[model samples]
Target: TLAPSAAPAASASPAPSTTASPAPTQATDPAAAAAAPPASVVAQYTALTCAPSDVRRSAASTDKAQDWIAACDRDGTTKYLLMPASVVGTDVKTASAGLQGGGGTTSINTGQWVVNVEFTGSGQGKFTRLTEQTIGKQVAIVLDGVVQSAPQTNERIAGTAQISGSFNQSDAEDLSNVLRYGALPLAFERSQAESISPTLGRDSLHGGLLAGGIGLLLVIAYSFLYYRAMGIVVVASLVVSGGIIYASVVLLGSAIGFTLTLAGIAGLIVSIGVTADSFVVYFERIKDEVQAGRTVRVAADRAWPAARRTMLAADTVSFLAAAVLYVLSIGSVRGFAFTLGLSTLSDVLIMFIFTRPLVALLVRRRLFSVSRFSGLSPKMIGGRAAAVPVATTRARLAKRPTPAGQKRES
Candidate 1:
């Protein structure tokens, strides 16, 4: 049957143009899990089905099936790498053709959960043929060797194919994300591996969080010591940023099944320096204007243009690098990139919502501008000094220049 040739997903990026398959990082969604089968339960099943063992394929497991096969799910259960036995070892011609996302939606009204897939001309034709041959057979829809869905074809699917099973909204979305893009592994081979764990041990998690806490404290202390009163704003902004990050982490964990790992913690800790740098950029700009004799408020106003641009430029670079890293790297590395990118965004938010506004308020206060501990004082910033006058020399010194045209003194 000519079906969508299951080829390796694009490892570099989540194609913006279409729902191309991605080696996506999946987290469990509570709502979806509650509505459907617990994702963990589903994962365990995939692991066993795809995992390789000493036993060879029998009537149930085809002879061509190898011991080692990876599935398409990112939820950490990869037992069988379903490359559409029909499309295995074959090339899929990717096109700008009629293929597009169905804007899929999940429905449970029929008593069975279903995710309706959208396809174009070639896809529709191939899907129809596939359904015909695989009648009463399960066909695996996999991404990056992880299976997203394996549906039994009951009849010749003429118009559209709906993956019906333990799918909830989140599960449907995950499957849709892969199908919308395209995750087809053209070839399947045997490779040995034990199993995959989605999280680190408790001890590892504690150690990572402890290390990150220490780093953040050190940064806060440094900010206080150097910037004085202004440092309060710095620290406050950071605390607020931390709160936001924490909330997001928790929310995302619940929504998408994301869990914090040691690598992700490290990414957050590293972002401390990056966030702190934003404070310095703004503060230093204020100092420069103060040194030039501008009032603190005026300095703040003037400094914003330059400081905002600089901070944005630097943060943009960090965010882009993190995004690239997230796309290219998997597992822990991708986790790190995810956190780093998240923190970069938080840094931007804190700057606008907290830091800048607080700074504006502080600069308006008399004590803030002139306090000894304040980083904004003219003396502290090395204010511009007035020029000193020089006295003219005596007539005796002027007489020495009279012989310029005469013979040299011996």
Candidate 2:
């Protein structure tokens, strides 16, 4: 019985060896095993699961998924994703290539693309149609062969549709700027650039203010030295002009987003010079007339027209130059141009309103006209003939014979 058991065990051992040999043979044929269809592939073929039931449906029948995806890809990876219909709030049509539509020419440029779509009087209809048609379709917005966006329409849009994808804020801003500014009649080109840091700009403003203050002080000192008591008129005029300019700058800053840079400060300082020059011209003209033997009041009146003409001519040239520079330049140069123009305009306004009116008022005062300290007295006019003296009523009475009786009575 034991020998028979041993024979059976020996036969089982050969079976184990046969199984071990097949394992090695299979290990050597790994490439062949890998070439065989995977279990997952076999299962896929044999079993059929339900399709994804969660596909998002668009409100608009034409809203297609493919259009959105294309738009997203075109916009790059960083832009805010937005739907077109939401932005335009109107109906849009799917235009064929080179189709001219009602909105404008559907054109493509190197940096951007245009989608030309025709909108009905009820833009909603066109939007609905576009949304319905583009559903699940890759609708591309092409600009000069570069696709801006290709968004899949998820719903039928009742209004205008927008597809935004990977655009940066700058890109969106630039696009918006183009849309808004392109319709304007004016043309512009960059002519210069000067980058000024905030710190540097502040320092410049400080220095400019210091210089302007010194200049103003010198002007006031000279006015007092030369014009004496009447110099108050010059100071008052300057104050009024300064106030007007300050209010204007503040209001402009609020209204038009105007900024006051260092260059602008320079412009203001220069305007001070212009304002002073106006005063000097008027004063000198008045003095010359007085030296020619005219009364102060007469001289002031006579000098106005000539002074006005001269002021107009000078301001006109300054303003024109500023305008040209503003139109032709960019960046810091623009700041300079803006300041120059503003100063020129303020100069004109001050000359007309504050300076002329104040001077006219001063001339009407007897003290200003007669006092030597007022700088307008005829006696102040060097080498000029003196005013003729007339006898007073008192002097005439004293010379009369009745005056002796009045003296005895006193």
Over 4 Å off in model 2, which ranges?
1-200, 383-410
Per-residue lDDT tens digits for candidate 2, residues 1-410, read 00000001111111111000000000101232224433543443233221122111111123221122111112232111112222121122232122123232344423323232334455444345444444443333322212233344455555433433334446545433322332223335689989878698678778989988998889899899988876797788789778877898899999999998877777777777777777788888998888776778888999999999988988899889989999998987788888788878888887887778777887888888887787867787674556655677653434435654365545
TM-score of each: 0.48, 0.48
In terms of TM-score, how similar is model 2 to the real structure? 0.48
Candidate 1 per-residue lDDT over residues 1-410, each given as its tens digit: 12221222323222121122211212112232124333553453344442233112211232232222333333333333222233321222322212123423223244433455545666555555555554544455544444444454567666655555555556556555556555444446679867756454777888988998898889878887888888788778888999999999999999999988889999998899899999999989988887777777898999999999999999999999999999999889999999999999999999998889999988889778767678787766654332324688776534455456688667
Q: Alpha carbon lDDT of residue 253, candidate 1?
A: 99
lDDT of 2: 0.52
**For each predicted model, how many residue pairs clash, with residues at least 3 apart or on different chains?**
31, 48
